[model samples]
Target chain A: MAEPTPSLAPARPPTGPRVWNNPRARAIIYQVLVLGGVIGAAAYLIDNTLTNLAERSIRSGFSFIWHEAGFAISEALIDYQPNHSYVRAFIAGLLNTLKVGLLGIVLVTILGIIIGIARLSTNWLVARLASVYVETFRNVPLLLQLYLWYSLLTEMLPGGRDALSLFTAFYLNKSGLMYPVPVYDGIHPFMIVAFLIGCVGAYAWGRYATRRHEATGVPTPRFWPSVGFVLGLPLVVWLIGGAPTAIDVPQMERFRFVGGWHVSIEFIALLLGLVVYTGAFVAETVRAGILSVSRGQTEAALSLGLRRGLVLRLVLLPQALRVIMPPLTSQYLNLMKNSSLAVAIGYPDLVAVANTTLNQTGQAIEAIAVIMAVYLTISLAISGFMNWYNKRVALVER
Target chain B: MINLAERRAASGPVIQMAGVNKWYGEFHVLKNINLEVRSGERVVVCGPSGSGKSTMIRCINRLEEHQKGRIVVDGIELIADLKQIDAVRREIGMVFQHFNLFPHMTVLENLTLAPMWVRNTPRKEAEDAAMAYLERVKIPEQAHKFPGQLSGGQQQRVAIARSLCMKPKIMLFDEPTSALDPEMIKEVLDVMIELAQGGMTMICVTHEMGFARTVADSMVFMDGGEIVEKAPPTEFFKNPKSERTKLFLSQILH
Candidate 1:
């Protein structure tokens, strides 16, 4: 109702950080001050770094990226030689970290879901067990949990030829696990291509099925389509001898895993610890999300004759996910940051590698920059995904 | 509020209760309650807070369990058998005072929920049924809007719409308009009146005596978990029987 107000009138304080008098001007000044502080600090540090570098008889630049990395990795997913450049070594480490991160995210999410649903179950034993798990894990220090998991594995795992062998294919030993690797020998660049195509088709088919079910009560045979893409595509390639590539399943041998790649105990310990500790936190968030859904919603669903299972899957989960996802994203970001604790286990994550490079090369400024850039990229990706999911499931009822 | 009924209808009762008792541990909430409601009847229950007016209707839906006596709704006995209770619940719809509309759904979705999910009606059929009910409530235009976006009255009406979507034979409203703004209260009352006129059996827990007088065939007054009086709207308003009912009527009317 209050219109025709003059813009030159005294600025409301909520207009955000302002100039001494002008709100916009005040915001500008505040921003510039922050920028100036950061730049000034960076400049001073850079000057100090350059002076130190000159005095220490060293240079700072990407020239080091090309120098041979003589250090050997205990486990490498790709072809690697000590003769490779430092950049190649860093790439190998980065890929390894991604591999661990991806697996950890998947396992923790599954574990979190199971525990959360268990917490709300009507069965007395199940509920009590879930509650106990949540209370125990949530209260313990995560770093301590990591150390416990490390020791538990080291002490329990079999040693040498006495190692636990599952399916006669995978070996669990004191050092770590050795499993058959699927190694492709030739131009089956088409495996990656077919796999990507199969994934896209599976996603599309699922969406189409959902749409079809919503439009018509006719249920589509969606499971077969997904199974076909996931299982059949790989089979087709294998049957055709992969047209260009052939795979081999490695076996254990004396003093070595002769046929497949070996996963170091350090990597397993880091991933296992990270997943369990973070999964417990994620479980709490999931439980809270489920709790936030009012009892009235469930009652209403029940009144409508919706069965328990459908009510949970169709009605409750969509709404609960909206509440769960925001906190869940924070847990994921925390897990990624906490993964930096890999230094404790001698795993070379981005931060760990950067920390070592800083100490060895005396290029502290560059090392810190690399750490910041890598983390910032990771944080941004997680944040973007969370925002997208938030938009997708936000309560339309509101 | 509108009062036209002068006497309780003379008929066999559709709902019968005897020696009904309920307690929340040591608190004897509903005690020795006895009542009857007939088919095609509209009854208004009124009392002070903690009088258990809401609990009585909830017991009909098995939303709250009574520890003693028995309640028979449309010939189905309310008992320990959960399946029977659910079957009876599907036949009766209850609207809440808080307008507990699902905040994650649109008004249309709210109205269609019970029909499609419970009744196993197809989406299109449920949507059509919902539209009919929404039209009855005079908020069909707002079908796509989320419940939170609506005013209290609108939300209550949508809740009523949601209950009606099940095509329930009986309706129980727990203070349907209590939370609405005064101006919006009439819109909901009007819809209730239309439903009554159409012979959809209703038991409303409300303080709107004016509404009770107009739409209700009889008014049941409760106090300390017992029915104090049951009379037609005209006699109930003009000359309430019991001393407690008179006192309550005085305070509420004033």
Candidate 2:
């Protein structure tokens, strides 16, 4: 390792290794090769698919979406006919999927929180019951649960002729469940306006009460006032606006129910399955979240003379929600995706409609792509909202 | 509740325990303990870990139930009755070794919580009281900061402030300075000394013999689940009676 002359220093000898043998250069070269390989594979696959489609004379584009879908759906939230375009059918299917997903999320969240708290109850029997529920539903296969619920709803219930009537306004049969639909004919706008005004007033009063309590020691009636504003104001406005009072009760005709708010049996089965299955995972997540909080927190709250309920509401829940939310968001996404299982029970959700389109048109690639796109869009939207919520609740640690 | 002057004139003990025994699944933790702390008296309880000093003070507020005992705080006996337990707990303030201040709350919020919720004090009043206590601990500027952002000494002072906001008749400190750094211990100890000078009834479990010398009216020494000796700090340090007390003092003082 002798030093080179000044004149030759610019062209120094290789002290360590050649450029190709250098670790950094080798790593870059390897990464480039991997990237090229992936690109080449994708390009080849795309080319092969195009050539095969051309050979079979099967047009490959989304233009088929505009074609009429000549198939009747059992349950349609919006107006639909066999002559309706595939796009319309897709929209209807997407709406149904969203309906189940939204409702399941709400129901599962409530059930999960209750069961989670019950699992930690001081009462032995309550705790044991919650444990049994979580274990039972969580262990069973979700698809099997859907099948069982569907059978229970359709096979066990009587036909529409002998519908099980409840309070003479609601009826349940093998076809579906139905209940009275409220008709506000001409006074709808006034009632809605009154309800909105009441909501704003109630919110203002709540803020004022909180501020007054902070300034003085007097506690205001918060809960009852909120209830009154939300319910009473709307009722009063309906009466003042000449309450329509033309409720349409479910009427059982020869073979089916007519003129009422009806929920299809397929929708009910899917909802029950999604709620029961996803709820178990959510319960476990809730339990884990609560348990992650140290015992010292509870003892500290209790020692401060906070009652058990207040301790739970203030100290326990705020902390546990931070832990519960991130995982709970994933569970919600899982529920939304699992709603696709409705296809197995003849429910006209997004996936079920897509499958029908694929079978009729022999457009496997197009149909699969649409299905993936819909699911992907939904999942991303859910994740975006969840991430925002997660950021708000995360602990501000130094 | 009697006025402070009348209650002081009565000379009744703020805390009393007789034949107090506790067990953790047949493992006897506290045995045949008898103690009394009068109003405005500062008692220091010191022993090695597991000697039941912390457990005994915890029993004062019913944080730990004594299986066999009549533990009374401010005339409210410790029992399974929720009302009695709540009453006793309301009148007592507690500090922990880890400075178990709520991490989610600011120093001011931690101090004001019990005053507002338990005492039904107005939020404005609770905040003012919290600020006063924070100033007394000499860290009023840290009120808006969360516990996690504060140093160990500062957090401990905030815990002290939180306890004081309850306007408690008695304060219990479970190794308040044990978890602090060597340099930070004096800061917390200084706050404790100020509290003692203010005539707060305090039962502290600490190994800081210097703090004991400065603020303790009486020192209670325990070993093997029994109080080996109890006497005024002057007499206990100079004229320890039991061999266990002598041994404990020798080891800890060194």
* Best of the candidates, TM-score: 2
Model 2 chain A worst lDDT window (10 residues): A5-14
In the range B1-254, model 1's lDDT, one tens digit per residue, is 22223223444677888899999999988989988888878899999989999999988888789999999988899888867887888889888888777788888888876676566566787788889889989888999998888888888888888988888889999998888889999999998998998887899999998899888888999999999999989999898879999899889887
Provide the TM-score of chain A alone for each candidate, in the order shown. 0.82, 0.90
| Candidate 1 error regions (>4 Å) | A1-37, A120-132, A165-171, A179-261, A355-360, B1-28, B32-35, B65-86, B120-125, B226-231, B234-247
* Docking quality (DockQ) of candidate 2: 0.58
State, as a TM-score between 0 and 1, how close model 1 is to the true structure. 0.83
Superposition error at A199 for model 1 (Å): 5.2
CA lDDT of B140 in candidate 2?
Answer: 92
Q: Give the worst 10-residue stretch by lDDT in candidate 1 chain B.
A: B1-10
- Best candidate (score: lDDT): 2
